[model samples]
Target: MKENVFYGKGMGPIKRDFPDIYEAIVELNDAVYTGKVIDYKTQKFIALAIAASNSDDRAVKKQIQSAINEFNATKDEIMDVLRIVLLTSGMPPFVKAVKILYEVME
Candidate 1:
């Protein structure tokens, strides 16, 4: 899949380079899947918001695009959550995320 492109390219090396960190990420993914904190779609949105708020462009774009592809989330819905992220996290993060999203779409 398009998302796998990054990992398949060269990111796998970095992931494997840090076994402990990679394991923690794997554990977190498992918890997120198994935990009942929210429904799958909502969880995806929350994760997208957090990534966007952290100004992690690659992560933000990946999660947002994944949600769109997997859950059929509309652009407006994604933007709404992004707006909330901006409110909670601040302008800088929001702006960075928006720029990344725009770049990805283009």
Candidate 2:
């Protein structure tokens, strides 16, 4: 089966019901993801860290998978991202992101 790109179960209806909001969200995602001062790979890692810090499992998983699949991020590289989480957010979010990392890496 294809990996579910839609992170949340409820997002589909929101996209359908509020096309304008969904379009705006997509535009924002594209804007932030574009290459600027930061390279794309590093940008992805930053996004991963942000997602991990937020302790959103689906976001963490998606970011992790994106890093791995797009940038071929290694285990060590992932650990490097999570270290920031450990430092700023504490162990709970770090551990949760780690768990999500493992789930996606599997």
User: Which candidate gets the maximum TM-score versus the true structure?
Assistant: 2
Candidate 1 residue lDDT tens string, 1-106: 1222232244476587976866676666676565366677887788889888888877888887787787877777888888998899999998888787676566
Worst 10 residues of 2 by lDDT: 1-10
TM-score of each: 0.70, 0.81
Candidate 2: Cα lDDT at 76: 88
For each candidate, what is the lDDT? 0.74, 0.83
Residues 39-98, candidate 2: write the lDDT tens digits. 888887887898889998888988888788877899889999999999999999999999
* Model 2, TM vs. native: 0.81
Model 1 residue 24 lDDT? 72
Clashes within 3 Å, all models in order: 0, 0
Model 1 residue 58 CA deviation (Å) reads: 1.1
What global local distance difference test value does model 2 have? Answer: 0.83
